[model samples]
Target: MAGQRGTRVAGADLVDLLTRAQRALVRDLGTVLEEEGCTVDQWRVLRALAAEERSMGELAAALEIPHPTLTRVVDALVDSALLYRTQSEEDRRRVSVHVSPLGRTKLNRLESLAAAHERALATRIGPETVTRLTDLLRDLP
Candidate 1:
């Protein structure tokens, strides 16, 4: 049987729905990111580091990215001069990643583009519905 509009299917689960939504949203945002010479993962790393420097382990956990994959992403950003790594002052064995000034400039542009994309999405779907969905998603465990 076909699933009714705005209604869940009998076999559908929250994980499936969330995954599908995430993929679709990422694909849409990927286009904008591509124009800026960045990948979605790279964009995520930059965004996370914008607030403050973080250890690789901390970043991986906070971003929900695997350690190896996050390392590669960080490496690429470092090569681009968008990010830098430093030995931790508190722990000699630990290192922290930080966004560089160049990264901040790029992030500013990316943020504007992302905001425009979000606004477009809000216009397509009612803004109130988008706001409600965001609130609901944030409330989820």
Candidate 2:
């Protein structure tokens, strides 16, 4: 029983550490996203849409954003002409999002910025360490 309790406490500590690390990373990336005229959440949506047209539900799941929040984000992006909404030809109830030419231009710029940010992170951590961390993160539960 005592061992189980200790394990639980350690698990909680791990969770707290992960949370802090995630927040700090997001805060750092948020600055670069902001300079590109977007919030991190918005960038996630744009990044997902950059590849191909996706339904609203697809975007929501791909980005792990709640449906309501995604709706607002999609609306704003549409308003800004960064994305276009088209009703699915097979289903009138479904709407798909596609990045416009302007959105593509913006996405290309943001991709460069993100690459530089990633390079800076690798430089700080050492390339081998960054690769190991990336693998570990991919395997995280």
The worst-scoring run of ten residues by lDDT in candidate 1 lies at 1-10
Query: What are the per-model C-alpha RMSD values against the true structure?
Result: 2.9, 3.0
Show where candidate 1 strays beyond 4 Å. 2-12
Write candidate 1's Cα lDDT for 1-141 as tens digits.
Answer: 345645775447677888998999999999988899998899889999999999999999999999999999999999999999999778898999999999999999899888988999999998998999999989987
Which residue pairs of candidate 2 clash? Answer: none
- lDDT per residue for candidate 2 within 1-141, as digits (tens), equals 888766687778888988998898889988988898887777788899887889999889888899999999888888889899988779899989999999888888888888888899989989998899789989985
Shift of residue 4 alpha carbon in model 2, Å:
14
Number of clashes found in candidate 1: 0
Model 2: residue 101 alpha-carbon error in angstroms: 0.6
Candidate maximizing lDDT? 1
TM per candidate: 0.90, 0.88
